[model samples]
Target: MMAAFKVINQYWLISITLICSKILPISSETFHTRLSPSYFSQKLGKIGTKLIINGIDSHYRSFFARVQHLTTPGFCGAAILDSRFLITSANCVHSVKPQDIHIEIGDFSLQDVQMTIYDVQDIFIAPGFNLNNTPINDLAMIKTEEPIPDAHQISIGICDEEDYDMINYQKSVFGCCGMGSTNKDPFIKLIPQVLKEMHFRGTPMDESNPERFLPCREDNICTRPMIDGGSICNLDHGGPLYKFRCGSFEPECLYGVASYSKRKADRHFQTCNTGSFFTNLMYFHEWIALTFLQNSF
Candidate 1:
């Protein structure tokens, strides 16, 4: 009797696993690749100079100063609006103390640029952000002690009303930029690895309410490509998401800071693919204008 019971249990477990795999389908293989630490280090070395923040140093770009915490160490972020400010998800730094946050800029290989440490005077977390839901207001801003001159001149993308119409059901391509995780868990290995491909087509918008959920507009589509917590950015968080405009692709607007993923419903024990989300910056346009632009530094 005991032997028969064990066999039945094993059969059921395998059956369920197989069924779930089919429903999600593990995304497309054209999407996944495993990246080693050495490869990531090399990639960072190549792109590090372009990721300047506050004109202080090149090393500062390695990690977003505000988001790193004691528990999950060495997380990455991007500079959104030049060197002075960085836009990252609020969840990244949810546990970090304000005083502990530090920004590393300058040289990629550790010796070229001087590192500048800035005190975070204030942090603006978006309203109505739910840890469980991962709502639209997942955005946050980190204000540094001093402004880095020439940081504003760096090109950043802006959201336009036209994007809402163009993005719907169109073959839109988004580049997923960020550092890969060093954590190794058996379950995490199953999904299509995130680092191999930099960009992919946006998934079609499901028939869902736009007012409550994100990617609220037609042009404002969202992606679950890969690389969570890392901003979907070029060198910095405030980096632009370029759309093919006019005769050529231009960096017209900046979108949201990349945030956490929604878990798969069926897999109670395992995390689904790295379903990345970004905090929509459009919601806080007035606030940004008031605080960063109009207010005296």
Candidate 2:
């Protein structure tokens, strides 16, 4: 069953998830032939109709990080925000101790794990956040045991009103990666088969759609794949939802962190074409900056 979590101003528990999909084998014909749409679908894979196909090292861009719970043997997706701080869902790390949390950056492949794991020194949750409530102020700033490398420039998510309206009106698609489990059973023993990339778009909640749910609440952003082949509800708990900047000259920008899915029909299982909800980064902008300012000083 999917975990039940609701953030109505107060903060609480839940996670965004990514599942391993079955991809067919590709060969020389795929590269040489002028293939059909179905061929490309098979090559790209129908599981997640996304920009970056899963498991391609070149496809990975900057600022992506993963949150691992050392005590629980589970992981959440996360992102680097600066040299000393990273961001993730507050609900994700809610009850965990600071020392038990580990953050991994500069790693594209979630498996064959690369780079040294950065241990967390302190975890900053939204000031108004309450562990007893739903995940409203659903963000967390993690201070690393040491500063990130000087060469790394973390992706800054869109928080200003101008960029927020631009992406929504433009119907921009965002990408996320997960090392989380699939909703299906027998998933317990499975390590993520490949680094999973899930696709979603920011959209208005249309309760009229009949196939989805409430879509989002006041502090949430609705994200869904354009087609029925994939689901955001199944991706990793703490993954970042990010988009490219307006031009080729610009870098990738993170905008949301996976929180919880607004389930349709109040059922634990997700239906086909269901939309998921994210902890809207802009909604927590003031808190984010304030947290950073207060701590940095």
Candidate 3:
């Protein structure tokens, strides 16, 4: 009788396991926190479908300065002010020392082991740069230990207040590039090995609701892609947003510096569905000019 009872209990447990498997399918969305090529391929069968959710490979005609820490590389992007100086977001270098900061310029492909890296001699965060109230005066200048080669230099000017006011900010297409994440999911960290460029236009602010986009005050410039689907993600902060002439490869005037992205209060990740915020260089023209002039002597 005891042997019979034990055998029945074993069969009952097996029956319950089978019932649970049938009720709950194995391929539920809750189990997947991240998306990948293999997951799609398995679900949709390999029918030659490709996923491109980020910017394309940028041409070498434009100049960009990549600002990062030696250990945490690709944290932000920057513009080469000259052979000896670079401009970036204050948040990128605020807490770090100059020695630990690494600046790499003119590298189309970051994977190349032969690429040269410059050392940081000094860093100056613009006055009134507050981490508590971020993206406000979110600008910084990096001084290189050795002067960068002049051959890589280009005549890029900062957009002044007059130009900013006269131009239709929402109408013109701006060129931006960075070593940012290719994937929309920031947690996945899908940073591209090559520099990628995307075209986006400034989003017009609502006069009635001026304070809707918090942390992004009147001084900041917001952007929306004119054509593409994805926006800038992590590792793109401190990058430049500039205007280029029609059919020209070289940038004309520097307007904005990448700062942050829009997200709800509860969400931990920054969404790419909307435009990203940038520190308006046009608003800080006086500060930048003064800094450059003082250092000149």
Candidate 4:
């Protein structure tokens, strides 16, 4: 009887943790427009499949980290900025407390036992971050309690306006990886144990149709999957949007952070091929740098 009671208690604990993790403070004005990821996928259409439909397994990215709650697995993907700092979307940690979250790195698979997990020393959400808004300034920095081991410590690339513009206009192909839900079927939430990566093409601002694409503010960049039926969905949030050199599998520079996507007013289903918005990291480079300096021990 004691064992059975313990199992039931554990189950309830997990259920409550998941419920709390999903709660976010939203303004009434934006409530109708900005719904949860699952709702957005359901109202518009099916969310992407695979780790992104057709996404391939990424052995691992040394600089990538999984930012998640202690009880819930993960809500966002993050990029390591240095031995002590990492960056992700504000929405991922805005409502979370530093002591209640952890960072996982050096593991491609969620179930991998060799992954290193670290306690969060602090969390710094960007100024003027509004969860109800288009997740504007959707960036945050996390300081690890202890420096990550030297072997796994590396800086990720942050772009400047000039380079960002070039990539957008030149339509450079970039990639993102995460362990988000593989499929968006309302009845199913299929997240794989392995990290997955998919490539997307930069969608020039001029080419974006307001009628079809969500209202992408100046702080955001738009992208569409390189292939049909591909996209970054739930859990891909806060992951790096980065580029690679020709014929290279390694990431070269960071451009953006996966933010949010919305369906057209007239559309009933979410479509991965239409494109999605990412928080432009170049716009926040100065702020992030300043934050690093202020917090450096």
Best candidate (score: TM-score): 4
Location of the lowest summed lDDT over 10 successive residues in candidate 3 = 43-52
Over 4 Å off, model 2: 1-58, 130-134, 154-159, 166-170, 185-190, 206-215, 233-235, 246-251, 266-273
Q: Residues 1-297, candidate 4: write the lDDT tens digits.
A: 334335332322222222221334546544334333443334323324456555666646777788878766566899988889888889889988899899887667445637788999999998888886357788899999998877344667676566665434344567787777677442356778778877666665523355443444667777766545567766778888887554334677787888865444445454333455788887787889899889999
Ranking by lDDT: 4, 3, 2, 1
TM-scores, each model vs. reference: 0.54, 0.71, 0.72, 0.75
Candidate 2 lDDT, tens digit per residue, 1-297?
Answer: 122123211100101111111223435464234233444344335443221222211235467787878888677778887777888888778788899978876656534556558888899877666543235767788888788886255556554665567335235556666655544322333345445566555666734247544545667677655334344433365677776443211235777887754344554343323455567788888878887798773
Per residue, candidate 3 scores C-alpha lDDT tens digits across 97-194 of: 99887877666544572455899888989999877534568899888888878734552667766546534575555767787777667678776667
| Best candidate (score: lDDT) | 4
Residue 196 error, candidate 3, Å: 0.8
* lDDT of model 3, residue 92: 87
lDDT of each: 0.40, 0.58, 0.65, 0.68
Q: Estimate the TM-score for candidate 1.
A: 0.54
Candidate 2 local lDDT, residue 164: 67
lDDT of 1 by residue, 74-120 (tens): 44454446555666666555446656565544323343335455556
What root-mean-square deviation over C-alphas does model 1 reach? 13.8
Candidate 4 local lDDT, residue 22: 38
Q: List the residue pairs that clash in candidate 4.
A: 44-268, 44-269, 44-270, 45-269, 45-270
Candidate closer to the true structure by lDDT (higher is better), 1 or 3: 3
Model 3 regions lying over 4 Å from their true place: 1-53, 71-74, 109-114, 132-134, 206-216, 247-249, 264-270
